[model samples]
Target: MDAGAGRIGRALGPGRRRRERPEVTLTNYEAVYDFYGPGRRRDGFTHPLLTFVGALYAPEVRIRPETVTELHRLHDAGVGIIVAANHPSHHDPFVLASAVYDRRVRFLASGTGLTKDPLFRGPLRPVFEYTGTVPVFRAKNYEGTERAVHDAAAARLIGLCVDRLTAGGVVLTFVEGTNSSADDLRTLRLDSVKKGVGQMVRGVRDTGGRVAVLPIGIVYRGRELAKLPPRRPVVSAGPLALWEDPGPAPSVDEVRHAVRAGIDDALTDAWG
Candidate 1:
C-alpha cells in the first residue's frame, strides 16, 4: 500500500521524579546538544557524508537557495524549524539534509531502514545516529492487531521530538505519510499527514518556544537519480502552520488538512 515514517523519538529528561537535581550539575542531553551544537560541523553528516549520500543516492540535492530568505531567518532564531516535504524518493531525507549546508538538521528516519535493512547496518548507521536522525518504526505497516504496540513506540519518539524542538532544532519530515509515485518507482500517493507534527507545534507553543512550520515541497522530473534535476527544493514558507501564537491544540484532522494545503501550495509554486 504505502511506505513508512518515524513516530516520536525517545523522550529526554529526568526519571519519574521529574525534578532537576542541581547537585548533578549537568544533563545527558546537555552533553548531547553541546556535541551537536553550531560548531558540530565535523562530527555528524559532515560535508563528506553529504557528498557520499549524493553520489550514491540523491545527486540532485544541492543547496542553492533561490528564495529561502524567511527560511534562513527562522533557522537563525534558534528555536525549531519543521521542514515539511513530500516523499518522492527514498533519498528524500538526504536531499533535504543537504539544504542545511551551513547549519544543522535532524529528521525522522525510518527505523527499519536504519536498523533491519542491510543497506543501513554498515557505514550509514553510524552517520545517521550521530547526525541527530531519530529512527521511527511505522506501526501502520503491522496493519491490523498490532496498532497498540506501534502507538507506544511512536509516542516515545514523539516525546523526544518535543524536547528537541523546544530546545532549538531543525527537523525534516515527509508529512504525506509515505513516498509518492512520481519517479515511477512507487505511486504518487499523498494520502494524509500524521498528527505528531501538529502536536509538536502545539507543544512547543505551549512551552513558549517559537516554532515555525515551513512547508517545503520537493519535485522531481523524469526517473533519473544520478543526473541533477532541473529544479531543486522550493522554499515558499508564507502562511505557516502556526503563524501567530497558537491558541488551543487543534484537532488532528484540522492540522492534517492545513499541512496538505500548505504542501500543495508550495509544490505548485515550485512547479511554476
Candidate 2:
C-alpha cells in the first residue's frame, strides 16, 4: 500500500472502510449568519463532549475562584460579555470551555477550521459546527475576488457577534488571531490584538446596550506543546471592563489597548 493509504489504514484500524469525506462548500456569509442566528436551537451534545475531551486531555486544568465569581456577577447583571483570550495552544479552546463550563458561550473561530486537514475535519470541525462558533474567513488567505468575498464575510461575522451580544450571550475570541508556542508563553504577553473585536464591541454599543469585555489568559505546561491533548493548563480571568452605550464610541485602537491590558493582567494572574 502507498504511504497515504497506509496512514489512513492505521487511523481506521484493520477491517474498517474509510469514512467518506463530506463535501464542504464555502457558503456565503448570509447562510452562515442565518444558521447561527438567534432562532437556532441549542446544542445538547457538544458541551458535554467538550467537557469530556477537556478532562481526558487537560486533566489538571486550573482556574481562579475569583474569576468564576466575577463571571457570575456579570451574567447575573444581564450584561453581554466578550471574552478576549490569548491563544497559546490548540488545546486552549477545550481548556477555556472547561474553565467556564457554567456559561453558554460561542467562539469566534477561523473558517479554515471547517475546511482544513484531516485532524480538523475528522474530530475538531464538528465541535465548531455544533457549538455555534462564528467562522471567520481571513481575507489574507484568498486573492482577487475571492479575497474581497472573504473580507466581506469577516465583516459580517462581526455583526453576527453583535447580535449574539445584544441577545445577552457570551462570545469568546482569541485576540491574537493565531496560536503561540509555550516558549513564547513564558513572556506572558499577548500578540497584537485584532481589530474585529473592537468592531463587535462598537456594533453592540451602536444598538444601545450594556456590554462587558472579559479577558482570559490560558497557559499550557507540557514538554511537547504540539502534541495532541496538552498537559497541565492554567486559566485566569481579569476583571470585567464594562462599556455603556451613552458614552462616546471607543476607537478601534482604544479597544485593542484595553483588551491587551486585560489579557496581560490575566496572564500575570495565571502565572501566579
Candidate 3:
C-alpha cells in the first residue's frame, strides 16, 4: 500500500477493515485509450459520485455567491466554458465538483489517474469514464514506441477537448498540470501554467466558436502538508474572460497571460 493509504488504514484501527483492492481489467494504455476515447458513450451518470465523495471529505465547502450567479448566467447563455483551476491536492476535483454541481462540467484528467492503481482501475475508473472525463496520456510516462503512442494519444485528446468546446460544453482542467504543495498557497504564484490551456483556446478559435475560460481558485484552510481529502477547502470563481477571434487569433502567450490573470483574481478572492 502507498504510504498515504497505509496511514489511513492505520488510522481506521482494528474495528474498521480496509476494503480489498478490486481486480483491474484495463491494464494497458491501448485498452484505456480505447475505452475512454471521445467516440465512446458517456452518460455522466456517475458524476454524483464526485459529489458524494466531496461531501464526505469536504462537507463545509464555501463558494462565492456572485461567482455562482455568473456561472449560471454563462451556462444559461450557452457559452462554452473551460474551467481553469489550481491543483493543490487530488481532492480538488471532487471538491470543485461539489462546489459547482450545477454546471455539470467534464474534467480533463490524467490518464495515469485512471489506470495507475488497482483502486483507481477498478472502482473509481467508472466514475471518470461515465462522467465524460477526458483522459490524457503524458508521453513522459513512457519511452520509445510507447512514448510516441502516448504523444499521439495526447494530441487526439486535445482535439477532443477542442471539439467539445466548439459544441458549447463545459470542461474543467487543472492549469498547473501537476499538483503543488499547499505550503505555496501563501505565495499565490501558480506553478507555470502549461501550454495545453493555450492550445485548447487556439483550437476553439480556429473553429470560430465562442469560448470562455473561467478561473477557479481552491484554497485549503489550515493545511500544513499535502493530504488526501482536504478539510473544508474554499472554492472561488472569478469573472469569465472571453477569447474570441475577430481577426487574427490571439497568440498562445496572450491566452496564457489572460488565464494567469484570471486565476490570480480568483486566488485573491479565495484568500480574502
lDDT of candidate 1 vs native? 0.50
For model 1, residues 1-272, the per-residue Cα lDDT tens digits are 12221111213333422222111111133433233222222343455776565444433332225335555566566657676766665556666655443242223121111111222235665565555454445544445645565666555555556666676766666675566654422222235566767776766766777776766566554442434433343333324665345466555566667777777766666556
Q: What is the lDDT of candidate 3?
A: 0.62
lDDT of 2 by residue, 1-272 (tens): 89999989989899864644333323445665555444332357665775686666553434456656665676667667887878777776666666656343223221111111223235656666565554555544444546657667777677777877777777777777766655446443434677878887888888886788888778764532666666567777776677854887677777888888887777777777
Which window of ten consecutive residues has the lowest lDDT sum in model 2?
108-117
Kindly report which residue stretches of model 3 are placed more than 4 angstroms away from their true locations once superposed.
1-34, 39-44, 59-70, 102-122, 143-150, 181-184, 187-191, 224-228
- Which whole-number lDDT from 0 to 100 does residue 179 have in model 1? 60
Q: Which model, 2 or 3, shows the larger TM-score?
A: 2
Candidates 1 and 2 compared: the better one by TM-score is: 2
What is the lDDT ranking, best to worst?
Answer: 2, 3, 1
Among all candidates shown, the one with the greatest lDDT? 2
Give the count of colliding residue pairs in each prediction.
Answer: 8, 0, 0
Candidate 2 or 1, higher lDDT: 2
Worst 10 residues of 1 by lDDT: 108-117
